[model samples]
Target chain A: MKRFLLISLIWPGYLLAQDNARQIEMTQLLLIKNHQVLSGNKQPDGLAEHSETVLRKAERYRYQGDFDKAVPLYQQAAQLNPKRQGYIGYVHLAFLHDYSRAMQYLNAYDALTPTFDDIEGNNPVSYYRGVIYLKTNEFALAIEQLNKSIGDIERKHGSEWVNYRYYVSRARAFLATSQPQKALDDLDKAVANYKKSALAYYHRGLALVQLGRTAEAKSAFQDAQFFFGAKRVEALQAGQAVIPEDQLFPLYESEIEAAIDQLKLKP
Target chain B: MKKQGWRNGKKYALPGLFLFGFWLTTTAQPLTRDQLTGQWIGVHAELNNASLCPLSTYLDLRSDGSFYLGMVDGKAPPKVMTWAMKAGQLRLDVLTYALDLISLTNDVLRIGQDSPMLFRRFQEIAVDSTAAFQTLNGRVWETDSLRLSLFANGKLLWENCQTYEQTVHCWQLARYGTAVFLVTRGNAHTCEGDYKPLWQLTQSGKQQFRAIGWNGQAVATETFRLVRPLKLSEMPPANEFQRCANCFDGSRYSVAEPFLRRYQPMLYDIRKAFEQYYKPVVASGQSGLVQIQFAVDCDGRMGRFLVKGFDNDYQAKSFDPQLVAQLLTICRQKLPAGWRRDPLTDQQQSDIDVLLNVRLSNGTITDVFL
Candidate 1:
């Protein structure tokens, strides 16, 4: 079976070689340059643009740690295209761990549309900034930023319309600030918004533990364990992206189990 | 066609003539010095059937039996070498290539057997450099089609003005005879594989400059008028520009043949050797994956042991210090027994990165992936 699988993997290489055989011409240099800048795994000539093509190209360089090429391309894309600024900021905060640069881009993006909340990829720009502040341990700033994403929506359209992940993010900030009651309030709303949210149950367990509700905390942790497993299987079966809340505040299956194990030993 | 004659003695005459013709085409033919004397422009090098590395390097084969191999842009220094056709084989410097492997057809020269490099005869077009430089240097130029900024420091910014999309590159003026070619290529951060475009300057003035070459698609004349002088602060971003960026940097070494196949028995032996040396450190909260990556040179010497750990979440986490130290010690000490003095090392041409990902549960090795 292993031998067969290896052969299957290598069979495409021969097909690829046969497919790429073309008569060489001088004009094909344009095609070569286009290939290098677009779909190639090879190094690019740093031909940046303020379009989707350039943004995707910059992402490739950034992922490969080719920061010299990546930085200039990203800067150009974000500077020239106002809409791309927030997206770049989100990528910096989540994947690159470049907090300062993320803040800079996010600030610039927010300035463009001050009155309205701006969406960056799947989440709001303020939500990404809140996660960045949380990562840096600026609990107060994190909560303030989170409120702009969650509170503003809750005021206009009520809590039901807001994403459950936003509440979970704010709840994490509340927990960091030792505001257990506020954390519990947000987690409850998060649970109400999405009943099967493992993140909500996990944070609820944390808040309950903080408030000395041991039995309830244990139950919340059990619910978290059940939902976490279900979510993992669902994501695998459907090929869905790993739960987005995990990018902001990681919640592992082992962590929930560890909490349960610790609570069991507390007797 | 001669099958009936093959049964008779007369068949030998036809077969002999065919053999002679094949020999003439394959070996008897010798390439003349005059045929290869002119400048050749690089096209593309076929590394394999699937891959083509774009070539900007030109070969200037002088009539004096000497040659210069370098970039067409004149950005890099040329390498001078002596060339001669000896015994129907082409010799450049100390390297000799088989006669059958080379072909010159319609002014295009194809060289080499395994990885064929193709080059076309260059036509030197004349244009005044002084006037071109006067219009180009330290100024921003804009056209209906494109936007270009040429800095005095030899840096350039090119943009598709129609779409407001831009790219940063290095530019230089090369004088081929009386012609001034505006050469634009990748910066230091980019690889040599990046394509370099040579634009022939056709006309130039204080207000406008015209060039005919690759306009991102086909060879065409593009006219640009002066927009403004480049500010002192404007320059190509040189932050973290590595002269030669490591190709393997930030990339995981995939398990490839013949490293995995030809060395399968050796790899199995190495894995067995690890089982004997690795002593699992039993402790709580140590369950996850640990990947130990190292490089083994052609001489069977091992070095650069790097260890990375991830918890159940797959997030970057450090394993227990003692556990990590033990793994490093095994890699540094015990792993060499399987590699050092191995006969397989003799066949290797380059150093290869080896990876071992181990799954641990409570610090006990559950599985090992080579």
Candidate 2:
């Protein structure tokens, strides 16, 4: 029993070290990869430090409500990182609220990174690409991205290591495609993963509604009120079945909020 | 001792403050509400020739933001119209009557004077109508069972027909040998339900002339002119001349037929193309009418045609709105001297409406400018 306890305690540290090393290696590869694709104002920035500074500067501009200025900085940072091009380009594409362009960036990211590789476990970038696809209502592509993110994390750690929001988002994306049956299947598994999340119930209800399961759908939407706070109105009642003009932005803000919660990241 | 003195001074100051407040209310600058309520005479309503009409009316402005136009009576109805006061100018939204009264400077109601009265058709009262108020009209009148219009203009327009790019309607004319008698229509209203033919005041003049019941022939006539069509406030004086023994009634044959048969060579070509493009609503119909609205730009060239609605007496779908749009496209593409653009005056901000009466036969359209 003592030996097992010792092993369990050591396992987390060993795994963390492995992750750190991988992060460093990936950072190096990111810095060296794809030197081409740099824009007009971004050339000859003596690599990583300059790129980091540009990213920080972009963040500052973003703080100042200068989205136009900030986006280019983030884009330059990604180009410099080379390994980050896949994720960084995707992030800029997504946050800048250009969905079609974000998809273009996501496609580039997907091609650069192999389909089988497990990079998204610690990388928030892969999850975001799935989100972009999900927002565009590209269900097949979103599922593909989410599945890869899940598969990578599972390989790195275990099935339990998969990001909770990825599963939830996958389900939501499924619903967006008008395939409530498939989405319901995802939600059933999603609730199993994180029953405490109100989103699981709320989304399950939405899926049920789409599938014509009115009673089940109604119950889920009511339960979701507990998870989503005041924002459940948009989901509980279809506020505006309006089409979204900004492609990268989530059609429903609730999904973006839920994603931020699962990622434990502040936008 | 000093504290007691300061405390006593506060009581003395109270009466002076109360007196000041009373004086403010009594001396405030304002004209009486009644003075502001009546028809403040500003602009005279006139015919299309810009000749002032003899009748006059003022607008009644209420304190509650509702508006009433001047009628002959002293009392106004509950609400005259949806009115808004913008920058001292009165804005009246009219729904059918082709009414416009622009008040000049003298007729303007001074801020402190009696409520201004707008007297329509009064030259002096309507002098400032242009300066203080602008009125738009919308009206619909009917003929016998047919809803004919008095001033050749349609009763209602969706977009500000005045403001939109191209809005078209139909107008017909008559041909007497080489003499082209440009046709004008009087009110759809009649003593007994009958149509009347009111022709233009010669080729140059804006006023219309009425024809004493004529030898109503079945000659084809189509002429559509793009000049600003006039909206008549009253019908022309009815002539007593009548023929007892004739199939052509003064109302129908002398008026409606000649107006409908008025032909345009180019518009007819477009209509013919429409018939060829779409199966005619009336099979074996050799001739069809394409009722279209187009813009006449500053140059004499015709602008595009946007059709609001369409009706075909024969089952002929030749004059479809889509086909009209295409015909208008061709007109813009081909006609150089067709559109006209006037110098930038405060008045002429957009192209004028041109209602073309077009005929279709063997894939060709003849358009008459009215």
Candidate 3:
């Protein structure tokens, strides 16, 4: 009787403990899948059970574009569990565009997950870093980072996966450094991959003009106009254009016009 | 006493069995890594706690252990991570995270603890040739004097106005040995008669195409380019053929009518200026159509002005071209400031060709149009 009583009393409690542990584990998995940080005070089960709830709330906030509210929750989740560093880094880099904070999170992620290889070309850390450098006008550093990113992507995903934007950015950097020929080469690749972008043709025109290829420059300018006009018309028709009047016009219209004028005036 | 003890044992046994059943229900069978090597799409049930909307998500796990996770909406880039089945749990490299193996089957996979989400294995279906044909159908290819329209039903219409020949044929596009060939049969009009032509097609670039003969030589005078589609409403009236405004090279102004319509007001203003200055010239028995050629540069400035007189049938009239040019130069200087500028080519201030035709009958200004 005593043994029966003891077993009955302890069995439910043991089952309850197991259920709780399973719940925590499941919540951790959910958090991971959702790209949220796993966190919480360590329970006797060695799982941060509360972190899952925090991450869920953070994700909700992030989805709603409430970054001010979401960032704190993500930070808290990261604090509770260090494993979330990578996801937090991605959120900061991709969503918030906070380079410094993203870099910090990425560094922490690198420290924790030191064995992570970027052989799949899916990792956007280097790409994001390169973009940040480009935006900041650190052309040399931008080129270095973008080179690394492109190399990794080409090796893993083949040349097809290396998008036109990468080439355009590198070309812009080359142009800034006065490497007009290199810029032209990159612009050619960019145009080949995605011909609809007016900016590529515009830059190509600039590069051609720099090289004193007057006829080619004129053709490139005309192409830029054609593509820009087409896109402008498309945007206007779609009703998604913020500025309807400007949407049908190209960026740097005045600059291109001036360049054409200069070319015509050249003896 | 023994009966009472047995009853107590039976009571406890029921509770024990209940606990074991609960454990069995909650603890799912462990899944092997091989079982996960496929694309899986599922719903995240608790994505938004406030709303009951479940967000669809995808998990593409390759045999190489690289996995991509993304929302089904495709708004976000897929997150990449290396995954492996470790110690009966799934370990992801990036997050340094692990997922407890729940339940996995050939079709359905369930993962999570308290509220497990279910996923379905993705199966890819083969695409038929009809789908491929749809991509190339209803497009027109053109060159200087040749136009070829490909229809969805495999009908091809080739018009060569220069040769005064129109060919209607049943066409089939086939790929063999790394080359796409256009095989045509039926009443294809040639100088000789109806014939069949098997032309091997090669794409020079996105916009350009080259058709070669069976002997592997380039087809004579055959250069095909993609034709930009224009609405019927944008086409010029029956008797009026479209040509570039300022040039005599006979190149057509193929831009949409809506684009040209935007400059009507400015062209109207220029007309009024012409009437103010040249109305007297028309009134003085100099009644003829003067063709003025000018370009609006990217800076919205006018340049490269030329003028000549032509009769109603578009033949060069007997008026002195230099006199018309001199008059146009004077009028160009007096032209108004409201050229509006071509928005499309304005960034580089691309030169927009403007052609004006001023008409006069019996020394009176009759009409003006572009």
Maximum-lDDT candidate: 1
lDDT of 1 by residue, B1-370 (tens): 5767666757577998899999888773456767878888765555422245445667787878897776665545677888787687777665666666678876777776434666767777677787678778899987777787888877777777676545566677878667777766554333232344556677888888887554544345688788999974886555422212111221121222223222332444455556888787889989876778776543455655678776654556789999888777777777534342323233323344566667688998765544
lDDT of 3 by residue, A1-267 (tens): 453344323322221122212322322345344333223222424334456667766765544334456778888878877667667776665444455677777667667646653221245556656666765679999789878777777898876677767777788788788888998988887888787877788889888888888899998888877776687677656743312221112144445565678778876
Question: Once superposed on the true structure, which residue ranges of model 2 sit more than 4 Å away at CA?
Answer: A1-46, A100-126, A151-160, A230-267, B1-370
Error of 1 at A58 (Å): 2.2
For A6-82, candidate 2 gives per-residue lDDT tens digits of 43233222211222123222211211221112232345457876777677667554433244466677677777765
- List pairs with backbone clashes in candidate 3: A39-A51, A253-B347, A253-B348, A256-B348, A257-B348, A257-B349, B298-B349
Ranking by TM-score: 1, 3, 2
Model 3 clash number: 7
Stretches of candidate 3 off by over 4 Å are A1-56, A59-67, A77-87, A110-123, A153-161, A209-215, A228-267, B1-370
**Native-vs-model 1 lDDT?**
0.65
Residue B193, model 1, lDDT: 26
Query: Model 3 chain B — which ten-residue stretch has the worst lDDT?
Result: B243-252
CA error at residue A102 for candidate 3, angstroms: 2.1
Rank candidates by lDDT, best first. 1, 3, 2
Angstrom error at residue B200, model 2: 79
User: Pick by TM-score: which candidate is best?
Assistant: 1
**Which 10 successive residues of model 2 chain A have the least lDDT summed?**
A27-36
